[model samples]
Target: MSAQRKLSSIGGGQKTHQFVDDSNRFEELMRLGHSDVQIRVVKYGEESSGRRPLVILNSIDFPMPPSEQFCDRMWRARFRVVFIERPGFGTSTPLPGVLLQSETIRNGAASMAEAAILQEVFRRLALEDFVLLGMGSANSVCYRLAMICPMVALAIFSNAVFNQNILDVFRPNWFQAMLRQTIQSRAGLQIASFGVKYRLRRNPEGFYGQVLQKSAGDLGYLQNNLADFERGAELFQGIEAQTIEYDLNMSLKPDSLLKDGLFETTNAVAFSGLETTDHWKSQLNQEAKRLSIDVEYAPNGDLYAPYASPEFLLKVITDRLNRLGAAQSG
Candidate 1:
């Protein structure tokens, strides 16, 4: 994604900046004796460590390389960026090999543990008052984080919804169907992260065409993202006869508590793309309004629009934060 295409490593170190968001601003955080199971983290600028700063979790397993290509400009601005890889994907280890935790207990524990570790990222980094950006799948993670962590200053969610609220004509059932296929095909999903190879699986030409398009067609952003999500265990359903399990067996506990508990300290901004389903567009507006957070819209597709329209988002967020600043000052 970098114009360089191939970046020589700065040192024979893990901290090379291949395509860091705000490329000039980030350095890979050394393991520092922490378990590798802890997700990878990179600071936005060459700042002293031990600051909390704004912690951002990309949706699900989205790669920093590509996101950097698309949205690095935005990430470089306003706030320091902290990128986290969720458990089961990216640099984070999928629950310990030992299944002693049980599917349910382990799932719940991991999310909490992940949140707790994130707080550590803040404390260890020495920054205070965090912000969150959960695009697509990460929206759920952000939602969970807001409920679990009181220190989060703001939460930004894009192209993500709960419980299939938007089943509009703009939606793509076949896209999810493909995920179902990937979930079912043990061989298919393991290689999802492989990108080009996975693109060739069904239609190489068409897939690559979409990637270069920078936005999805009528199928929209979610479809393109589902396509881009180059990683995951073979769709669990791909391995099993049943359909994909939307089990947030890990999510229900925290999410339930969030729904029940009154959320304070954290403010929010919900963004949706016009190309998205009417249901998605409406649902996000209503929810954000109800939650008392600001809501914004993008004319672009779901995936890249948050990225594509970063300027617009920044304006909305900046204006809101300024008002917030004024209220505090007064």
Candidate 2:
């Protein structure tokens, strides 16, 4: 059967269709809220499995839909994996006035706006109880979701900086430091976004090479996995420049979801790459302690742990799910 026809047989009308050339996954553009913003949702695994949902928020740097390989792995593990493209990324419509006011972006309004959209997504998908998985900067949104979405049974972050100030405390490379400064003003962010788009369009391989150079571990993995690297570069290049600016603006700010008692009702864990700087590891450790969650280090892992250490990530996730199951049964 044709992919579209096959997907149509599964239900949900035109809103859901097979992802381009990928039979194992389907994408849906859901119209959400009064503003009629369209949120693109990608689904993996069989809905009939009745497994608890695994909702993933991918890193802003590569804010693309989950890969076919990743989706197959999750499906084999019996997870109904759903990847939601954050507002402004992928085909999802940007939140209204996302770039208009720096104050709104800084004062937690952006996070709240995203959280509200996510809440509606969960409702629409009937994801009453699910595990939340976040990668890198996207973990900031995960925090806001965990705070407001009572249905989040567990939250996991991979290579995330919970506190933006940690960059200052640890002092990243000059390039990384300068990248953070782009968010201080709308103009700076737009300019930086334009530069990124230009570089990706002009010479994608070089752009990705330069990007991965900072993390030897990730670079090595992608070097051996050329297909994955090319796919990622294509996705990264597909992101809109304005969306890039908005995503960075929200991610670079000090996380406002760290309010008192936010995680009291939520269970959370973190995974960090051993290849990351000691300062980053230190910050992850401290934040894990404050949140009263466990942290696991993936040997030879780096900032791109999601891409480079998928097996390790899966193992950690499976272990946690087993423990949660055990606790609930007990």
Candidate 3:
């Protein structure tokens, strides 16, 4: 069952979203086995021109479709962007018994389930070769996909969490640390997730303001691109609290993804902003070295590079694709 509608400006409670350019974007629900996965497909250029496909697994903090402006740039650069609203996020159904079990959440079974669903989704889309782009926590899913799905020709990650242990290096404040420990339990996680959802609904601006304070680059981008930031935040509010709880619990696991050697066979590159915290930079450097993959630092970029430094992101993609082409020809 699939349906399509023209993209248009929408108004939230107190905020008006006007930055999502009026473009030919449509949402479709893909029936995979017993569940339906919602996907937002935005095409930019001519299909007959052989535009490449870019599969975006959005970060947990920003689990929304890309802005029309961002999609337009990808289209102009000959790439079709597909945004997957993962299970329990948008209208998509959560995998059976995956999120309900604490054992699954703590053991990373949820991520493996997501990766399997994504692999099936790619096969149905007939995407034999596509670029996989992941941001933040979604990068774990990307690593898993690249290892299992041969269709992933190139994997690009931005501001990715290297492992669960890296969070320890952040040395969070006492209150933050307490909250993190509290969330280890199911009841505490539910309460925290609900609190976050409430904050996002009632005072998104303040919520995001506090969240981005650690990265000046992201904070400046949020201040400068309020409309764009708010647009994403509006979509962010729609995500289910259960989904947030599952992601948070999974991130706390010591053996999640990279820590278990899942990234060993992935063809990937990681990017971080130059102005990111020393803790993040140090972890990313160590992980990149351990994985033997390349890490590029974007000038004046940060956690919000997708929204703030689109040009730099595009340049990196274009250069990599060109190099791949040259290598194939040679």
Candidate 4:
């Protein structure tokens, strides 16, 4: 790992978060245009010439730490794993003002601008030619990045969200509108932030349990990994709530790519669990058909598998990477 990168508070009077860790995983805040983005980067095993670096873009609201065991597996497989907290989450600076635009065309342009921010992040880090992994709504941005950026050679989506319907189904239109309003209103944002902190603190178990139940994952896992889960939540301290809201709002929009040549320029994979809704599965299959990409299904895992069952998620990614390695060697 590179030398520890120093972090400073972004705005005057804003609270700062200190992230010192024993695992040698470094977290840094870097300026990107008018916003500051937080990135957590870790490398396992030896850096070999044979494998490509892997970048994992987590969900908008989750700044969850990368799975250590999964990272170890990637190392043994010859890949370096990087977990990044997207803007408006963790310690990353959020865009100023209400992000909801007046028109659909303008919303699409905003989505493109967000993808461009990822490109800028790569340039700032001097990173290139890496495989991109995105989970849930984050995959939407990854798809856009892989389509437009030459350095993204492979794009992987796990329990990917491809349409506005997914978000609408998960949370009704009225609820989303309420969230948008709370995120934009200062007093509302503080109250909402306080509610999040209170639940995560007072009922971390019940809190994470509700999340795990969505996929029917084992809640016992959360019990066993309580400390890790708490640590991951700690990373969210002092993060900009508006950024999380921004991504959430953006996620409710349609896919960023034109349907014609979705994954044409990049090798793609969809890793999902058996419990995924039939409608989502059908949509994913259709998108995969369009891109000529296969969906790799894990028998007992679901959308939140990466957090709930890291081993299952790791296997899915490794299987694809192994196939690519074999084909290249042949």
Report how far residue 120 has shifted in candidate 2, in Å: 1.1
Residue 327 lDDT (model 1):
79
For candidate 2, which ten residues in a row score worst on lDDT? 1-10
Residue 252 in model 4: lDDT: 52
The 10-residue segment of model 4 with minimum total lDDT is 9-18
Write down the TM-score of every candidate.
Answer: 0.65, 0.84, 0.81, 0.73
Candidate 2 displacement at residue 217 in angstroms: 4.8
Question: CA lDDT, every prediction?
Answer: 0.48, 0.68, 0.66, 0.60
The residue-by-residue lDDT of candidate 1 on 1-330, one tens digit each, is 223232332222233343343344343433323356444565454444333355666553244422343335544554545666544444544444343133434344445555566655555545566667776655655666776666776677766554344423222343344444443443443443243334445554455345424345323433444434333222211221110112222222223333421334457767766655565667666655555555677766565456556666667667766776787899
Candidate closer to the true structure by TM-score (higher is better), 2 or 3? 2
Give the residue spans of candidate 1 off by over 4 A: 1-34, 48-54, 65-72, 75-78, 97-109, 167-172, 179-255, 258-265, 289-292
Clash count for candidate 3 is: 0
TM-score of 2: 0.84
**Could you say which candidate leads in TM-score?**
2
lDDT tens per residue, model 4, 1-330: 443444444433222233435554445555554434444434333333456677888775456545565566665666777666665555555444454343432356555666787787776555577778787768767777877887876777877755525543333343444455553565665666666667677766666666555355535446655766686566556566555445554555455464755655467777777655676678767767766667877655464555555566566666766776788799
How many residue pairs clash (N, CA or C atoms closer than 3 angstroms) in each of the candidate models, in the order given? Answer: 17, 0, 0, 1
Model 4: residues with Cα > 4 Å off, grouped in runs: 1-20, 31-51, 98-106, 167-198, 216-221, 234-241, 256-261, 290-292, 307-330
Evaluate residue 215 in candidate 1 and report its C-alpha lDDT on the 0 to 100 scale. Answer: 43
Model 2, position 227, has a per-residue lDDT of 57
